[model samples]
Target: MPKPSAVTEAPSVVGSRLRQLRQRQGLSARELAHRLGISPSAVSQIERGVLQPSVARLIAMTDALGVPLAEVFGGPEQRDEMPEDLTGFALQRFGQGTEMTLESGVIFRRVSPGRTPGVDYFVSTYPPGSAAHPESGMFRHEGYEVGTVLSGELTIDFDGERVVLRAGDAISYPCSRPHRIHNTGSVDAVAQWLIVHPER
Candidate 1:
């Protein structure tokens, strides 16, 4: 098989990170999901990055994994710049998102089924004042997660208490909390996330 390039290597690296963390904790996907207050499917999705997890979800995953920001985004394989064409895969950008009721210029990248992974990797943007809620009253995450806010104001919601985060603010939270994310500034919000899960 041909060796994957650096850009292609990132998702796998991210996936591997999650798998390793999950193994360290000796937890199963279903078990982690239960602990994170989300469904196993969601856990699977996060591990694959087929879905963009909210800032709230990232915190929950990081709490579960017990790792720090540098471990997630600063990991070696992720150091490559995003691909110009990205070959066979594609990224979708929208003014609206599925997690919330309004269009907020959110950008999402589909990681799994589209790309091979040693771990999950995603690049997403949240416009100022854009936020995400649990689907139809459902909320929560599935494992230890981490996030690096790239721009604007990020509001991390833990139940009703809110943590207003700005550029360069990093966070870790337990997935079991009722959480949500909102862009509370006048500019666009961009962030990268990593979530880990037990090996399948």
Candidate 2:
């Protein structure tokens, strides 16, 4: 009889891979759970190898992590090779982007592939009652952000000023200002964002 492939779908291996990928993307367990549309506890279980992910869940996760499915199964050796066209234009499919959930329940999905230097583009979702920071406290980063609400309501507080936005509304400001965002509506809010980082 032929020997089985070493790359079996072992729960422990999968869990380790999952954890590594999540950390590489700077996501917490809660954030990954939110992006997966599952509970944090479930993510904990999955990471600890206490639970096995279904095929569908695995697919969703790989898509969210912005990695090819093979990377998850084939281990680290598989990641060393890059596509020849990585620096050029690329297409990201619907439901296929690097996604992470914030501690406050905000989901950010990177729409662009590879690094463009000084730019980050994303599609973000703010669940009802979610805030950009705990207690909607002010925070600052070294960049400029522009975003437009696609649906539902978004409240932005910047440098002591507050504004309510609805679908089709857009805002752009320097991230140097202390700012926070809140989802003040009962429905999920969606937005598209483009952030430009100061040249290093």
Give the per-residue lDDT of model 2 (tens digit) for 100-176: 44445566565554444556676778899887666545756556889999999999887758899999999999867
User: How far off is model 2, as Cα RMSD?
Assistant: 11.6
Local distance difference test, each candidate: 0.55, 0.68
Candidate 2 to truth, TM? 0.58
- Give model 1's TM-score versus the native structure: 0.44
Model 1, span 1-200: residue lDDT tens: 54222222244444555656776778898888887788999778767755555544554665566543223443343323334356545332342111211123454442332222224445456776666653424256555557778777777767657788777988876545667777778887767666554344
User: What ranges in model 1 sit over 4 Å off?
Assistant: 1-104, 110-118, 134-138
Provide the lowest-lDDT 10-residue window in model 1.
95-104
Q: Which is the leading candidate under TM-score?
A: 2
lDDT at 189, model 1 = 78
Model 1, 72: alpha-carbon shift in Å? 20
Residue 2 error for model 2, in Å?
43
Q: lDDT of model 1 at residue 105?
A: 43
Task: Give all TM-scores, in the order shown.
Answer: 0.44, 0.58
